[model samples]
Target: MQFADAKERVLSLHQQLQEHNTRYYVLDDPIISDAEYDRLMQELIQLETSFPELQTADSPTQRVGAEPLPFFEKVEHTSRMLSLSNAFNREDLMEFDQRIKKATGLDQITYVCELKIDGLAVSIRYQDGIYSLGATRGDGQIGENITQNVKTIRSLPLKLATPINLEVRGEAYLPKKEFERINKQRADNGEPLFANPRNAAAGSLRQLDPKLAAQRALDLFIYGMDGSSEVYTTHQETFRAIKKLGLKVNPEWKVATSIDEVWEYIEHWQLERSKLGYEIDGIVIKVDDYALRTKLGFTAKSPRWAIAYKFPAEEAISILEDIELRVGRTGVITPTAILKPVVLAGTTVKRASLHNEDIIREKGLLLGDHVVVKKAGDIIPEVVSVITKERTGEEVAFHMPTHCPECNSELVRLEGEVALRCINPACAAQIREGIIHFVSRGAMNIERLGEKVVILLYEHKLVSSVADLYYLQKEDLLALPRMGEKSVDNILSSIEKSKGNSLERLLFGLGIRFVGSKGAKMIAEHFGTMDAIVHASEEDLLAVEEVGPKMATSIVTYFKKPEVKELLSRLQGANVNMTYKGPKIVHANDSDHRFAGKVFVITGTLESMSRQEAAEKLEQLGAKVSNSVSKKTDFLLAGEKAGSKLKKAQELGVTILDETAFLAEIER
Candidate 1:
């Protein structure tokens, strides 16, 4: 095809895709099957790839991602993103209503009830109807620019049908299906999985690479707007406006004329939320009248106009048939309860984690005892309490395992620690679990490696350690049941790619006791290289902040192992990155500047930056960034639809800054 002809075709295809996206995401009325839409998208991508110069920022294909950023630049918002106060129950809701009535001197009020989505909050800015920037809710004032990643979400509109400059806020979430698929892939790749969809959504949105974010299949449900454009007037109107602009709005949103009605909606959803494709922790109730909301005004952190009604935790009773001990990759023995089947939340519970020996004894749990089971975060099932009265005299008192259940090796409890750990490095279960942890998304992130694959590899003796993953041949992988040629190739390619991960990732993947991603980064940066870390003494390791004596000892002891040394040697031979070059840090010379001395709190998403990148930038500028808003906070950087922190910041009278203003200040 001629260049001009191809360009025109691409443009037409983009327009068609945009309309399709609006129909499907915003309206939930798809004219084409998913397969057909994918085909069209693939065609457009191919054409764009062939004619790279013709690709535009607003192009539909651009949404998947661009290039990795060196660092996120801070952007200030024009209007401060305020959060809502929490209403735990009906009484809290009534109190909020009474407070609003007293302040407004009105007998009744209208509210916009929305699902409190358990996902990442983000701000999206559009200029002249074209999608421009997307950011996380950094200290409300400043946020990291994540426009490319936002565009990757099929639900997010790249260009609105009508031209208007506006800032829209929403929750970016991974649907249940996508979350399951991604988790399955991670599990197969011998990777640690996200605990829930919310974490997965947050993690994906914060990725520096938009392409990686795109692969996670995120979706957005716009709930509010930052400012008035040619859109609508009230919170209720904003929902319609967002829908009109080809943006997805929550389907469950309703206009409640009275607090009682709002309570009814909340109560209904509290039970029905599980049926939805996404996770929702609570219900958001916002004043429907935009002018009234403005009149009622906000506290330092939260707006008086809205409140979130959190659902009461779902709990059920089950029988504790037995207490089983399982050794983790780090050799820590975790006590699991073998329970008589009971439903908690939505899924059937057969096993619940006891966490450690301390929890087991603290609960006074015993075999054959009736136990109260609850889902924490509405995800993991936990044994909340033991029904001691219902327990038979024959019930057995649980004892902590003194040896590895799988390998029968002697277990030892470290000084001042409650956890009994199997110190055997070559224990089969430990090795399998270690391999899974190494390739986890938060670690090396080898896609297509999951638990099943790890088990198969272990059973076939194809993989004995984490290093053996890098050595697996395609033929060897294909030999496993249900493993096709393409699947094998994909897994092998992902494994190959994982070898080039950063030192921080490598550290985290090592499954060191108590060393998470943040700790890994700290240690990797402090030590610079793996060899230095391996050779460091406990005293040397303890020099790092947040590294306690126990953690330091654990690190030192882990590296001292002959198995770890051999694994490290093999990884080094495989060309894995061993030296830490940490993420780009932004620093300012003015230490006592307005923002420098201030402590800022951010919740929700900004239209331009990721939360982590924004926090890092603020820290570099001598500003303290706190997770929750408090009186100590000097400013609240609010974005889009902020949560509790915005409320507390308001109540504390902290200076609130929007994304645009934050950017201006940081740049200044």
Candidate 2:
């Protein structure tokens, strides 16, 4: 095909994909199936490959992502993203109404009440009605540019109906259904679960890879915008205007003239919040009139014209039937309370995590005892307390397991930890969990080998360890339940693909004690090869910055085990890449690195570099970057609207540096 024809086809495909994205994401109506979308995408990709000049920044194919960014650059907001004061109860709401009325010198007021979505706050900017820049709410005045990640969110329109330049504030959230699905997937893969929907949304948005963000199924709700120059006169009208321009505004907003009416709206939603798709922690009450809101003015941190009414946590009562022990990848035996099924926060709760023995004892939990259960963050179910008054004399006190439930090995509580752990490396439960973790998304990322598939493989003795995955035959996988020819082929393909993952992925998959993804990456980059890390002593490991005593010891301990070494040899024999494929890290002592002796505490968004980048740069220069500000801190790296850390630094007489100054210092 000619270049012109390819270009035309690519343009047509982009338009089709954009429309489909809008329909599926914003409208919740899909006209095409996943297979059809994949076919279109493949055609576009081939066209782009054949005619490279036809590729554009706004093309649908670009959403797969580029190289991982070293850091996110900060963008200063045209206007401050002010927070709202919280009103916990009806009395607080009444007081907020009175305060607003007093401040505006008016008795009558109108408010636009919106759901205070429990997710990451974002600012999306448009230039000539085209989606341009997007940022996170980092200290209100400055935010990290997340334009690429924002573009991956299908509900977010790439272009508006009108060609007017404007900025809108929205909440980027993962729906409750998606959150549950992802968490269950993670649990099955033996990965740590997301605590809540809000946290999951935040984590998804902040992902360095836009493709990762895209897979999260993120949605947005544009509630407010800088409407000072707009034709709209009220907050209620502004919502309608944005919605007309292909923006998603929550459909449940209400116009309330009286505080009592506002209370009624809040009370109704508090009870019905579970019925909604997304999570809302509270309701935001804003003065309906834009002119009135302007007159009301703002406080240092929050707008006087707006207030958030937080809902009280909901709870339900159920009988604790039994306490069951579940083994984790780390061999930690967690006690879960199996309860009589009771509905709480929209879902039926059958079990609640008792956490550890201490929590069980503190809660005085017993078998067959009536207990109050609640969903923490509308996701994790937990026993709030035992209903002692309802408990009968027949109740039996719960106890922690003395032996591994699956392998029957004696469990031991590690020094400095509360939970009992099974230290047997060959334990069936630990081995199964470890293999599952090895194939998780953040690790080897074997797509078709999910938790259930791994369990099946393990049960049939087809796979015992991570290395065994690559050795599985077609007949072995085909013999398992639900394993068709296509399924077996897909699993084999994914397993083969995982062998090429970077060294950090392998290190993380190994389930090293006290080593997380970040630590794994640092070790991988610093050492360059898994062999180097395996041979390194604790002292040698400690030489690399970010390698604390605990992590260094853990790495040394992990590589020292004969079983671990044997596993590594097997993986090596399987032709798995054992070298770092990502960027290399240079030691501070290797060169004349600036900021070598300085200690920095970053507070807000940096204009040139992401917070992680800044911290990494500091580490590369031998600086000890800490999360919290203290007397020991040499400098407080303050950005726009720097919070309590800035104030604390000022009080402590620590040097404060803006993004520009911080950059200059590093350069010097």
Candidate 3:
């Protein structure tokens, strides 16, 4: 084709792709099939490759991402992207409205209530009707530049409807279904599962390769303009203008004339938010009129004109049928409440952990009693409280069993411990649980080896210990029920692959009492090898940072077991990794590292990285990272809306560092 013909074709493809993207992503209406869209995209790529001069920065082909970046450059936000103060109940909302009314001197005020998307906050700048830059809200003022990743969001138009130079703020999110899809794939690959959609979105956006972010099917909802201007008189009008500029805006916003109307809107969404395509944590109420917002100006941290009303944890009432006892790998006997199937937090929860005998006693829980069940932030479902008013005479008070449910061994509550533990090493339940834990996602991460298969192996006597997992023969596995040749092959492949996991994973998988993943990592890095850690005395274990007296004792006690020693030897015989494989552990004695040897704890919502990421960075610098604020904690890295840890650190005389200070220390 001629150069002019190619140019025209490229332009046409760009227009077509943009329109289709808007129709599918923004309007949720598609006139063409996904195959047709892909065909158009392929044609555009071909044209761009054939005639390189015809390609522009604003071309639809750019949405596929550019080269991987070495590191993200920092960009200063035009306006500080402050976090909102939260209101948990109607009284808090009333107080907020009263405060606004007092400030603006109005009896009743108009406010716009929008869904508080559970996503990463981001901003995009458009110059002369072209998308110029995109960034995270790092420390409110400065942020990591993610222009390439932002450009990949097909919902974001590369060029505006008009030649307007302005900045827009939005929430970048992964749709719920897409989050599920990605997590399912990750699970199948034995990768760690994302905790939530918000986490998945944040992880995707922070990828070094923009192509990875593009593949996540991420989207954005433009909410606000960076600065107040005469261009739009009201907040709602700005949404209209944003839509007119070909930007996607969330359509579920409502204008409330009174605080009661605002409360009504919040009430409606509190029950309906889960039905939406993306996650919504709460509702944000903002002054609609721009002049009123100007009059009722900013606080030190957030705008006084707006308040976020956070939704409470979803709860459902279910009748407790019976209390069952469970044995952990550590032999801890935990009581689980079996409830009548009730849909709670988008899942049918039939079982909830009663936690311990003490909890049961404290709550006066009884079988046949109605209980309030809730998920502890989508992690575990637990019985929150017993509905005393719903109780009848037929309710039976639960008591802890004297003997282990599986082995019929006497259970004992160890010194200074609330948990009732079965000390029987030969317990069948303990062995099965241990093997299951060893292959779990955060441990050795053996893919496709689920709980049922572990139980099956145990029942058939095909495996008695976690070490047996590494030595599983294909013939034995193939002989098991429901085990196809393909299934057995994949399981064996995963088992073989897990032999090279870092020492920390193996340590955690051993189910040592009081030794968590972080503690395992610290111990592994400090000792450098499994042999060193296995033979280390309590004094040697104490040398490692984050190892408290109790933890040191637990490690010594766990390693002292003859069976554990034998298991370690068998694992060694199978050629499992016996040394730390993460970033080289630095020396605290090094002169240039000020944070070295210090104990740091982190809390709240960090804009740049997750808590785990920050902890790993600190560990690399030879600083001990703890999860709680204690007297030994040297610094508390507090982020947005820092809670009890921040207060506890202050009370304990621990030094505090903000996100900026923490980042500076790490960078150094």
Count of backbone clashes for each model? 55, 0, 0
**lDDT head-to-head 1 vs 3, winner:** 3
Q: After superposition, how far is residue 568 of candidate 2 from its true place, in Å?
A: 48
Report the C-alpha displacement of residue 539, candidate 3, in angstroms.
25
RMSD of each: 12.0, 13.5, 8.8
Where does candidate 1 have its weakest 10-residue lDDT segment? 583-592
Give the lDDT of residue 163 in candidate 3: 91
Number of the predicted model whose TM-score against the real structure is largest? 3
Residue 437, model 1: Cα distance from true site in angstroms: 26
Worst 10 residues of 3 by lDDT: 644-653
* Residue 494 accuracy (lDDT) in model 2: 92
- Clashing residue pairs in candidate 3 (N, C-alpha, C atoms within 3 angstroms): none
**Tens-digit per-residue lDDT, 438-501, candidate 2:** 9998788899989999999999999888889988899878888888999999999998998998
lDDT-based ranking, best first?
3, 2, 1
lDDT of 1 by residue, 70-162 (tens): 666677776766666677778888899999999899998988888988887788998999999998766566566888778888888888878
Q: Which segments of model 2 are wrong by more than 4 Å?
A: 1-15, 31-54, 314-668
The models' CA-based lDDT, in order, is 0.81, 0.83, 0.86
lDDT value, candidate 1, whole model: 0.81
Reference-based lDDT, residue 337, model 2: 88
